[model samples]
Target: MGDMITTSEQQIPLAKRIRAHIELADPITWISPAMICICGALASGTATGFQWWNGAHWGLILLGALMTGPLGTGFSQSINDYYDREIDAINDPTRPIPAGLVSLNGARANWFFLGFATFLVSLIFKDAMITALAVFGIILSVLYSMPPIKFKKNYLLGPPAVGIGYVTVSWMVGHIIFAPITWQSITVAMINGGLTAGMLVLNDIKSVEGDRQHGLKSLAVAIGVQPALLVAYTIINLCEILFLVLAVMWGNYWVAAFIAFAVIAPIYSQIKLYNDASHKNFMRYLIATNPFVALIQIVSAFLVGGYFG
Candidate 1:
């Protein structure tokens, strides 16, 4: 809340500026794609391990990570930061753009370059599916961040849009690369999508004040934090419950038990989110806990594959 300048912001070297901009991309956010890779592999009904000595399969994984991380998620984060500069100025002034570490033009150029390079890389794969997914991601990133059609402004559409982009579509891209596309894969993707959307809602709680100031009606801003928290918990718990029930219906009682056990972490996260609505706390909790949550899905997929294989 205070406009105090940190020492890190004082040192304005070229490398530091570049790092600042890259940091804005938030590479740590790649858990979405990572989870997808795992789930897709499991749903593909194939063994998920690869030979580190084999360049072909390993290369595909690396390429997927590059596209999903820098080109896709990076572009989204950069453009979002650009569009949310005003809000950042209020809520997160030390961010790259708001802190004056990167020029607005420089940020725009980053988005353009990443967007093009992602598509170009996808084309190199000579796979229509990959190219389409890449394009879809780019389009979603633009629509989510750009004005007039910035879906991020609408509480109803914003979180779901991101959930679809970050979870379902991203997961499909990873899945299709190594696995046959199937109905089961899509079901997994949708479940992950719902979970991610709920997590996004909790993430938004931290920014309610800034969103309010920016006239953005995020769920937290529109319905109050307590009610928004309830909605988030509902979305998250509902998905997990469905996964558990389906696991039992499929006669995979071990998978159901695993998922039931994994549910505890999210409940703990919700309690933490309820207590500390600060952006810093939410981010810390999310980063620390989201992967574990994703792991439940990943391991559940592992069990599903084992049971059906």
Candidate 2:
């Protein structure tokens, strides 16, 4: 809404403005809210967790939901790029910072704005656990990006750090909204986080060449490309299957069925590329669609709601 209200004395092309805004928003990469909800649905499906729809009426987990996806993510990414400008310049010259589409100060300003927004929105959670999770998301994001503890560059630690930040905080969404925390929620979130971390490994696999040149030791760099791809695919696919099986066995197969149906095309396409290995670019080109993968997750969560009375 704020971005849409363009002011006068602005001569920049509207297309460029829109495109720049998307870049500003970081425009939903693969790790979007889809997983948050899928993870949410799986968490919510439990007898203890948040029910899809309460018998009373429809309610929303506004706080954890907000902090996990658009708001928390937008701030985290802007700050991440601000700190990693040099590395990104080499690895991603076309990005807003390197291309001069956005300045360091402007990006920093956005980081502050979004961070404050997350904090303000977090009040909606009310519960101490939910509030704490939101705070953790903020801190982990900053810690993941900042120095002296820049976990982003650590091969073993980086992926898990990022994945855990997302999956657990997101699990809280369903937990507080539907029910309290359960072993089921924790297990599902951990497994789901593992899957996301695996997808991230594929991203590093695509960027290994650039990362090595930049002196960054990513998981992909540690394992190398071929092995890394295998590892990445294995984890993501495993997570997919694990959640599906768990849901089905619990008689809430709707979530798994929806997820499988949505991902069949992307998985097939990815497998085709792997068989050839001639189009490595497809790896990067495709990894950005993670948010789309996340969207399927949201659908899966919604489907889980249906299996209930």
Best-performing candidate as measured by lDDT? 1
Put down candidate 2 lDDT per residue, 1-309, tens digits, no spaces. Answer: 022112331354667744754576574742454347435745465465555456431335544555667677777777787777777767778876666666555566778888888787767656777667667877888988888687887878788877887665676565566666666667666776787788787777656667787667887687667677778777777777776787687677666676566456466666655665444546543764465456545544544444343
TM-score of each: 0.87, 0.76
Find the candidate with the highest TM-score and give its number: 1
User: What is candidate 1's CA lDDT for residue 292?
Assistant: 61
**RMSD for each of the candidates:** 4.2, 6.0
> Which residue runs does candidate 2 get wrong by more than 4 Å?
1-22, 38-42, 45-59, 62-64, 244-272, 275-309
Per-residue error (Å), model 1, residue 86: 0.6
Q: Please provide, for model 1 over 1-309, each residue's C-alpha lDDT reduced to its tens digit, 9 standing for 90 to 100.
A: 222234354468878977987877877776566556546555555465333355786677677767776678888888888888889999989888777787776777887887888898888668899899889988998899888889998888899988888878776776677765777668878888888898898888877889998888899899899899889888887888888887888788877787787676556656776787776667766775667667766765665455353
Residue 201 miss distance in model 2 (angstroms): 0.5
